[model samples]
Structures are given as C-alpha cells and as structure tokens.
Target: MNKKKTSLLPKNFLFRLTFINIFIVSIFIALSSWAVYNTACFLVDSMGTMTGTNQTKFNKTLYYYLWIFSLIAMITGSIAHFYLTKRLIHPLKRLIESTKSMKKGNYPEPIEVTSSDEIGQLTSNFNGLAHQLKKNHEQRQKLVMDLSHEVRTPLANLNGYLYALKNGVIEGDPALYESLYQESERLTKMITQLETLKEWDYISEQSFFEKEMAPIGKLLHETVKMFEWQLKEKQIAVEIDAEDADLLVDKEGVLQAISNLTENAIRFYSGEGIISIKGERLANEYYIAITGPSYPITEKEGEKLFERFYRVDPSRSRDTGGSGLGLSITKEIIEQHKGDIGWKTDEAKNTFWFTLPLETACTSR
Candidate 1:
C-alpha cells in the first residue's frame, strides 16, 4: 500500500488558522448578501405598477451588485486574515528555529516575548532552560579540567619518585618510599570518592531513605565513637547534647553524613579545641548540628561548602584536607532525606547543621 503524501504548507499553523478564518468570512458574506437581496426583492414586489420586464432587469442588477460585494468582501477578509495569522505564528516559527539551533549545541539569543499569552510564557521558560543548560555545560567542563589536574599532580609525583629510584638517580630511602606511598594513597582516595559520588548521584531521592527509623541521639553517639582515635590525636574535646527524637532515614547513610561532619570538624578545629554535637526536635523535624572552633568562614564560602570538590583552605594538601567530596556526599544524603544542610560561622566558631523530617512524630503521639 502506498502512503498518502502530506502537504507541508497546510500542516503549518498559520495556514490552518488563515484557512479557517477565510471560511468563516465567506459564510458571513454569503448570509449578508442573501439578506440584502431578499430585502431588495421584497421592495420591488411591493411596487404595484412594476412590469415583468422591469422587474427582471432590477433583479439582474441586484444580483450583479451582490456578486461584486461578495467578491470584495472575500478578497479583503482573506488579506486581513493572512496578515493576522502571520503575526500570531511568527513567534512560533522563531521558537522552532531556536530549538533546532540548540540541538546543534548552539544557543542563540533568547526568544523575544511579544505577548502575555501561553506562547510568550513558553518562550520565557525556554530562555531560562537554555541559560541553565549552558551554565551546567560550563561547570561540567571545568570539573573535568579540575579533576584531571588533581589526579595528574599526584600521579606525576609518584611516577617521578619511582623512576628516580629505578634509575639510581635517588636512593630508595624510607622517607622517599613513604612519600611515594602517600601519593598513591591520595590518588586511591580521590578515585574512590569519585566513584562513590557517581553512585550517589544516580540514586533517587525517594529510595534514598530506608524504612527504618533511627534515634538521632544514638546515631550521633555512634558517629562520634567512630572518630575516637582522630579526636584523641587532635586532643579535641567532645560534647553531645541531643534530644530523644526518631527520624525516618537511611541508617547507614545518616551515619555516614554525621561521621563526615564530625570528621570535618575534627580536621578543621584549632589545637585542643572543643567539638560539640547537638540535636533537638523542632516541630515536625529533627535538627543536628556539629560545631568546632575555627577561623570564621565568609557567607559566600559557606554557601559553596557542600559543593563537590570545594575546599575551604585552597592551600591545604589533600592528605590533610581530604578529597573534598565528604561534605558533598553528606549534603546529598541529607537532601535525600528531605532535609536541609548548611553551615554558619561566627567570630571564633564554625557550625554545620542539618534537619531531617520526623515522618511519624505526630502519628506516634
């Protein structure tokens, strides 16, 4: 069977709108001409002395005038309809062309919003979406470049050390071996964090939380316990103040988030400083905060603290500052639990806090 060929012109919105408008105009012209013709006939018939020949002539003249009027009306209506349709469909055409350009990875200028109609709203939304996509593209490119630079530095160091030792350019001293090992360790840590971040990115928010509800106080205690050795090494005093609150969360995910925050606090705290963990129930949510003494961070830096690969102290070595993905992972975990995480800094302290919804708090009561 042969498929029917479709006319591209008729498929256009302008063509369809103009055709419908012209059809309506034709109907109105026909009805108007009929009414006028009928009125003329009625007036002629009412003239009692009118002869058949005169009547026929008058009727023919009336029909001729009606035909002329109809033709004029049709021509004028068609021209007006075409102009109106073109105005209405011009924006749509621009949108289609812009989308095609975007498909080719070229974002042209924003679609001009000419009206407050649905099409105008759509144009505005498209502009916003294009801007966001361009921003994300730039960020992704930067991330790739940064990742390469980070990995290359450690790898190059390791390679240089190994090559020097193999060629007898440098003795295989214990310090040299330790340095090489540390470089290898840094590379492994960064790679592992990257993989973990990728997996976390793929996880959906709905499935992030497990069905079990864990006590906030207990989780905080356990998380602090895990960092006992680090706390001791740093001589950081610990304090915990928590309310008895249960949160609907993924047990392991929440644990890891708290652990990361604690570890962050431990790493950045001043020598022999105090680390405080606080938890409290606020309405339908439970809030957890970990604070430590440190130099104040600007509000701007705090805003980006949870972003992947963001470092507070840019000069600090990765070995001391970590892969910079720990806080990012923690942010993701808290967000997946329908929570918010942020940091605040004062004159002599920095605090990281997060809130998780108490899903059954009211029901249990």
Candidate 2:
C-alpha cells in the first residue's frame, strides 16, 4: 500500500511562549497560596493572645479565613490563566487563519502582530516568503508556456509526416521521404536544445562540480576540432588570436560554452565570414571576445540576443540549423563562471561580437 503524505502544522515561537506563560503562572499560584496561609496563621495567633480566646475557637476562625482565601485564590488564578492564554494565542490564531487563506492560492494580507516579539518577526518573514513564491510561480508558468509553443510546431510537423508515410497518403517518393526525415531531424534538434536549457537551469540552482585553472588555448583547440566538420561544410574561415592564457573555470563546461558561441559564428557569420577569437586581461579579470560578421543585425536586437529562444531572425537561424538556444546557454555558462557575456552588432558590415570573463589566470580568446 502507498503511504499517504501528511504534514503536521508547523510550530512557531508563540507556541513556546504559551508553555512558558503557563509554567510561570503555575509557580506564582503556588507561592501565593503559601503566603496566604502564613498570613492567616499569623493573624489568628495574634488575635488569640490579645483577646485571650480559647485555642479551639482561634483554630476555627483561622480555618474559616483560610478556606475563604483559598476559594478566592483559586478563582483569581483561573481567571488570570485564561486571560494570559487568550492574550498570547489570539494573534497566532489570526496568523494561522491568514496562512490558510494563502493555501487557497491567494496572497492574503499579512496579519499584524502587536507584540514586538518573535511572533512579529515570523509574520514579517511569512509575508516576504509569500511574495517571493508568487513571483517565482508566475515566472515558471510563463517559461512553460513559451517552451510548449516552441517545441510543439516542429513536433507536430514531424508527427504529421510520419502519419502521411504510414498511411501512404502520398506516393512513396525520395523527396517525400527526405522531407519527413528533415522534419524528424528538426524535432530531434528542438528536443536537444530544450534538454540543454533544462540542464543549465538545473546547474544554476545546483552545487557545481568544481573549478580549476584551465588553459583557454587547449580548450579552444579541442572545441574547434569537435565542430570542425560543420565549419568546413559552411566554408567559414576561423582564426584564433589567443595566446597561452589560463583561466579559472570548469574546463569541460567552459569548452562547451565557447563551442556554443563559435557554432553561432560559423552558422550565421557568412560572406567573407571572419570569426576572430581575441582575448585581453584586465585587473582581476581576463576578457575573451569573439568577433564575427552577422546579417541585418540591429543594436536593440543585439541587446536581447541572449534571451531564451529569442532569435534576431528566426528564418535565418532555423535555415542555418540552430535551435536559437545557443546564445542563451552560452550566457548561462558565462554567468556560472562568475562573469558576464554580451555582444555588439554592426549593421553596415553585419558583425556580431561576444565576450567572456577570465577569473583566475591567463587570457586566450
């Protein structure tokens, strides 16, 4: 049998105060009872000696007085305990009720606590948490909607082509087959891009593996070789202006980051396409900048280039075979490196540029 998940109400500082107040009132009652009995005995003794009354009579009178005192003390203590408990617990009841309202998916107005005690602090914290949670929830919903729209189009086309082939809706020709295959490839690429974005999202909120001093030249060498085949097909010339610069980084991750940018350069920077890899070091940071030619790019578009799934020219990006997440992922990686990444685009010559930070060593770009 599956166990049902149940949570107990969270205890707070007010609960602790209730227990302490009860204990203190209990001790006060005990002390007050002892004092009442002693005073009654003292008065009874003095009256017996002064009036020369019989011991039995004095004892009876003292007994009656003690009884009356006990009765009054009991009533008074009961009333005080009830009052104290009401004072302490009423605010908490208000808080609990307000919090329950939040469970109904509304950010309730915060309950005001009068005492300058821990409960007041708790109320403030609760309000802050509710605001933050609401913001994050809204953001998550927007992200889901965007991703669904992005992933659905290619996937629908891919499924449609498969359906056509299976039912023989059209003649079994090579062009039809090829078209289906291309659509499938597009769908697969979209999935891969989504996965990459998901991984970075995970990484941003997770404890990273580690960082070490890594040489940029070697990282670039390996990355270039990995994508060398694609660059060759495009006939895009690649140039490196990097020297031996060691940067503090996660080596494999940094390589992946640079590869994403370079891939963009190869794909979009066309017609005398020059991908210049340049680097320079400043105080406490080294900068690696990628200079490449772009098409019909504007300054405003360049500023928003790193936004998720945002493309300067969607048709150009899709035709050149990219999922538009390349720049976004590159931005994430750079941010993880404790740095910033940005680009500038020139409309005349059609050039796009991006830079990365080097935290711990030499400079290579």
lDDT of each: 0.81, 0.69
RMSD of every prediction: 5.9, 6.2
| Candidate 2 structure quality by residue, lDDT tens digits, 130-218 | 77677768768877987787778767877787788789885667987787777777668767877877777678766675778888777
Which tens-of-lDDT digit does each residue in 146-205 have in candidate 1?
Answer: 698777878888888889888989898788788888888878878887776666665642
Off by over 4 Å in 1: 1-51, 100-105, 109-125, 171-178, 195-214, 228-237, 248-253, 283-285, 293-308, 331-340, 345-349, 357-365
What stretches of model 2 exceed 4 Å from their correct place?
1-26, 32-98, 107-136, 167-169, 206-209, 314-317, 347-365
Leading candidate by lDDT: 1
Q: After superposition, how far is residue 270 of candidate 2 from its true place, in Å?
A: 2.2
Error of 2 at 138 (Å): 3.1
